[model samples]
Target: MTISPPLHLFEAFGVELEYMIVDAETLDVLPISDRLLHSEDDLPVSEVEHGDMAWSNELTHHVIEIKTNGPHPTLAPLATRFRNQIRQINSQLLSHNALLLPTAMHPWMNPERELHLWPYDYSPVYTAFHRVFNCNGHGWANLQSMHLNFPFADDEEFGKLHAAIRLILPLLPAIAASSPWCDGQKTGYLDSRLNSYVPNSRKVPSVTGDVIPEQAYTQEEYHRKILEPMYREIEPFDPDGLLQHEFLNARGVIARFDRNAIEIRLIDVQESPLSDIAIASLVTATLQRLVNESCTSISQQKEMEVASLRTILDQTIQDGERSVITDRNYLRQFGISEPQVTAQEVWCKLFEDSRKQISASHPDAIPSIELILKEGPLARRMLNALSEAPSIEELRTLFRSLAECLAEGRAFHGL
Candidate 1:
């Protein structure tokens, strides 16, 4: 159930990071998550929970999800707890000769052949999607992301939070596009995983609605506009009606009215927990800036109408920081005074301003933002590394190095 609404605006935060379990040396995706999680007789308990940190299964057996207990007021402790949980999972993974990989998409896993749906408590929920959507595409099978949830107290708060989030949603890929390669080859799009996610729901359009989420304000209106259609569409397949909830509706951002919060699903997982928290901090700060300024009116958001926002988002996903920001009005809305600005400039300005809103000084300034400004997003960095590698074998070696960066809680410096 949704916790009582936050007492203050932007009072708490929660994060979920998804990772791929793979063979340590060969880096092949491992579908042994069930064995790690359920083999109590042969191994220790797979699910571990300590306070706000916990481990759980995902739609695919090769993937697992880690999340905090509830929204946190500070990011440093949250990041610390998240890192400790990763170490705990890695320790257990040693017995299985597997470990979690940091990248958003596994380099060479064919989801159709390798996909293993979680068949425990929510088996039918996954089963329905598998049967209908053929849940084996890169989107369903390989894509991993960082999901950030922020709590709201009431309808007014939800309205403000929703608007602020929608305004910033389009720009997220510019800072967090880490999935550049799929199927062991460079997918031309920087965030190729999103290509699958945004379009994969064509079979269940009622659920995802273009993957960029339409404008939603209150719980009743959101249910009518988004959730009701999904419930109706999935009812024939899901007789038990478990898929009727807001979470399973599959939009880029979901409003958990029961939980009094909105969960943003568009961000890609970053290189390290620190980077992830930095991005989270930037998001919170940017949203808070909008709320503090009281820019909750729908009229103020006209500059970022869905059509223009979608264009910008798609361009960022395709081009990374190099994507040109042509919407002068949209840029101006974000306080980009310059007429000619790139996507990175808008993000940099947000990062600079939003850092002030955060309580802790851990991420005084997001290194990823600076790095993207200097080089590009993680996808571009991966692309540069691919170009430099003398051979395919060398590229594989580089990915192995990238894995090391994730394990150590360090950012990948482009070679």
Candidate 2:
């Protein structure tokens, strides 16, 4: 990982979006990301830098990640930057009869047959992971996500940011869930990527202790409580210590002390960059409110139990926006007075309250956010476009439209 100087809270943000490369006509996973990255040369590199953005390979060769080259002062300009990168990559991929597809997981891919690991730089780390836990599953090869990383200067700033992130994690899937179909059928999970993600590291349970992180705020506490245990647990399996870094701590939100940032990994990548950045804008604004203690104090936020938050996350992962929240205590943390509310209602209230901040900072994102709130997440809209038992051709049609949305930089309004 690259190291940078520490930044104050919310001073800058880093965003990474992942997409899958698929055959143009058939929409099957294509393991030619090396061709996409090294169009001009024979050697395949792990990452390539392009102006203010960079393209990188993931554990699987079909999935590629594009991220801001570094922390940007604001997120307003990133939607356009990411979209432009997507177009350039798409143009290059056309030569090979492949194009980029958006969403969290490929609907019909069989990872057992389609999985191929990147065989170039950083292969050691990927090999270590593959050796410890079998990488031939949906959890390893078929998921795409948008990582939202924000800076925290010191221990005090870390405490507040961690607490605020915990409160907001469960509600994220409600707005961003996009993996409705997997293994050629509905897995009954709106965020099936995350549903599979939780057990990916079950061989060593300490690696991803519940998905919602434990209540460790300070750096010292985090190392002792989270990182050390994870390292100890994976040590026997990894004799060479190749997988003993901070990145191994696979919680939904993790403290990246190497980069002086905390990354939120629960959001599924949407159909377009506009949708991904809009969701990020709303989440940042809401975090600001929590850190300021406008609705609840830092003490109150830290007191939230990991089990309670995990239970809510489980519900949203299965049901998305339709999930109901009967926990008044959880609702009160967000300044909601209602005794009962749908997850969508909770998001609507947060969006309205943070409208001013989002409008001022990310004005371009308003319409996309509104579309998601009104219609439902991309997953729900996708289900709306399908029959009770959708055939493979119907799934292909729906995803092809999504690819066009990615290429044209627009939201997917359902049929």
Candidate 3:
């Protein structure tokens, strides 16, 4: 039988919100969103919830993401629809003097009390997911994310698609990296959401298959290749975090993308659309450039490619700008055998080299690098305002201000 290509790419667009909810009393984390808001008229995330209480996202998408189900084309229109959903939700939250700050990590979250209980109900999938994925009852992620997926044609196009995937993966934290506090105190990490999701997402080893690892790989291939094998009816709460691994594995590539593009799973919920747009645009443009005929793919790259990608990504979660340098410089600073580098220089050079690489491979992609170099990472700006805040409330207020500016279409720096 002749096989036809699957709509694996066909392009999709989606948005997820990673919120850091403040408790009514401690501002630690009430962890409430549309889920806890009790009202008959509260907006609905999808038809999944229909009840007197305010329900959304089936405990994941709304609280996890603010997405629109569509077969839309082009980032422009998709952005419009995505923005509308965000605005609508913002309008609801405004009734309470509250604002949405898209970020990855939150501090002192008491997920124990903060139930994912929606108005109508959480399905079997969520019930199973929440049990473990929402472990320790201290749920921490309350931010925003954007995803885009492109269709894979044949193996060749898969290479291109995978390149886009690889290019975007390391750059994920750079795009979102909003979380800076844990348990109300600054945890010194920008994207704490990674901490939150790893329990829920990563930690799974992509299965080793019958076919040995290939010498060369593509982003699309990585997506399909590095998945954990399916096991019979795995449950969360297994003594081993392996259950969590299984859960994450079962999710697979498009599992989350039931709606949009390759989901940019790393960002925290931003306060507004402009923030989303700027980061998204930069990431999208970078990915676009990276996937061009010249950009490298994860599997089929030169030596040190994997390590460079891993180090850049792993460190960016906390201090995309600084932590990474610290991580890379761990030895050098201690006078130990090092990679012959400093962390800051490592980060600067990583992207600097990428800039040169892109410039050489595809000159058109150089502008995105220029923009980041000019603007600096969002974490720096977040840290400065936080330092100025005399109180937690003030810091929250600063967060609100940034979100508002980003929402109002202000320039990133102007905000």
Candidate 4:
């Protein structure tokens, strides 16, 4: 690694948002990157290879996620910069007349559509996978994901911080808001495309090994204990870390670092810039609180139950807000005086942290996350949009509106 990875606290916040390009008139799928990569005038290429912010890959049209090197503690400033940067990049690609869209799922785009692979390591993994699992969902088609990198103070404050991060893992599916219609009907799961990966991770052994016996990890320890094991089992060129290319999408590189931070893997792309920053701040607060605290009172016996933590993580995505036997000690870790614990209570602590962080770091911004919790996951916004207009057009419009609202100034008052 000639270029040493960026320093912590400075780790650029990364967001992976997916949306399919489509004909405005026909609502048909469009491959803008495909159009550009083989277009008339040559676009400047990234010699660093897969490092470019945008490219035509086996996956659907991906808007290369550029890390924010600027201070991004607030939604207004962050969304403004992110929107401008993305638009500028999209415009360059549009020299070929290709349009860019930010959506969880393209209404008419078929995940079953046959498309070539992106130039990513996971291609081979997913390629072998389709033979077994029917590829109705394009594992690659313009995926909708919200990737957030929460900055950490250092590696020493690990253990429960990392575990707290994972404890909330089940909430993802409930909040998931893309790729609704699969196999010609609503799969009833917002992120069925992303969820496809969950079933296959069963056989793979994670570094932390399912949180039964919590292990503290330093930066080097985490990489060795967690990352290195997967890397060793997986073939060298496979970036998605496919343990075996037979059954899983293996998707892309989703990693978590020790120190003052943890990286999140689930979430679709934001329809607009507002969704991006709003979701980012919401997630960041939980991660920060988890850093210097104990999350759940999950005992070794309870954690080692017949189902196991991994099993819980698997089921929780769709079920949302899963709770096992949690007690008083865990609540006290985060300064919660309440002697009992529930999924919603823990969530309240997380939301409270967001309020504090916003008040201190970003006083003017209203917490968009508050809305997500009160109303529902971003999925509700998408569902309502689709339901009201009751057409594919209406669904996409609602999706975009909810996304833009993440940054609306009206929502940004003294929150």
Q: Which candidate is the best by lDDT?
A: 2
Q: Write the per-residue lDDT of candidate 4 for residues 87-182, one digit (tens) a residue.
A: 554566555544455545555565556343444444555564443333445444535566565555555434434555554454444444445554
Stretches of candidate 2 off by over 4 Å are 1-5, 39-41
lDDT of 2 at 170: 97
Count of clashes, each model = 2, 0, 42, 18
Error of 4 at 137 (Å): 4.0
Relative to the true structure, how large is the alpha-carbon lDDT of every model? Answer: 0.77, 0.95, 0.44, 0.47
In model 3, which range of ten residues has the least summed lDDT?
A: 207-216
In model 1, residue pairs whose N, Cα or C atoms come closer than 3 Å (at least 3 residues apart or on different chains), thus clashing, are 2-259, 52-69
Better of 1 and 2 by TM-score: 2
Per-candidate TM vs. native?
A: 0.92, 0.98, 0.66, 0.67
Once superposed on the true structure, which residue ranges of model 1 sit more than 4 Å away at CA? 1-7, 38-47, 294-298, 358-361, 388-392
How would you encode candidate 3's per-residue C-alpha lDDT over 1-415 as one tens digit per residue?
A: 9964344443543443344334323334443455434446764434422221112353432253444443334344333444555455556655555444444544434455544444344355555455544534433234334444354445555554544454345445654566666556676666665544544533222321211122224444444444323232233244444443322442112323222233334455554444554455445544554454343433333222444545656666655645433233232212224554433443344455355544453453344334444544555556665553336676656655655543453323423
Which whole-number lDDT from 0 to 100 does residue 130 have in model 4? 42
The residue ranges of model 3 lying beyond 4 angstroms of the native Cα positions read 1-12, 15-64, 77-81, 94-98, 137-144, 199-225, 228-247, 250-261, 295-299, 302-308, 322-372, 388-390, 406-415
lDDT (10s digit) by residue, model 2, range 1-415:
9965679999999999999999999999999999866635667888899998999999999989999998989999999999999999999998999999999999999999999999888889999999999999999899999999999999999999999999999999999999999988988999999999999999999999999999999999999989999999999999999999998988999999988899999999999999999999999999999999999899999999999999999999999999999888899999999898999999999999999989998999999999999999999999999996799999999999999999999999976
Residue-by-residue lDDT tens digits, candidate 1, 266-358: 989877776788778777778877776543344576335677788888988887777888887777667666777778878777766765555
Instruction: Report the candidate with higher TM-score, 3 versus 4.
Output: 4
Cα lDDT of model 4 overall? 0.47
Which candidate would rank higher by TM-score, 1 or 3?
A: 1
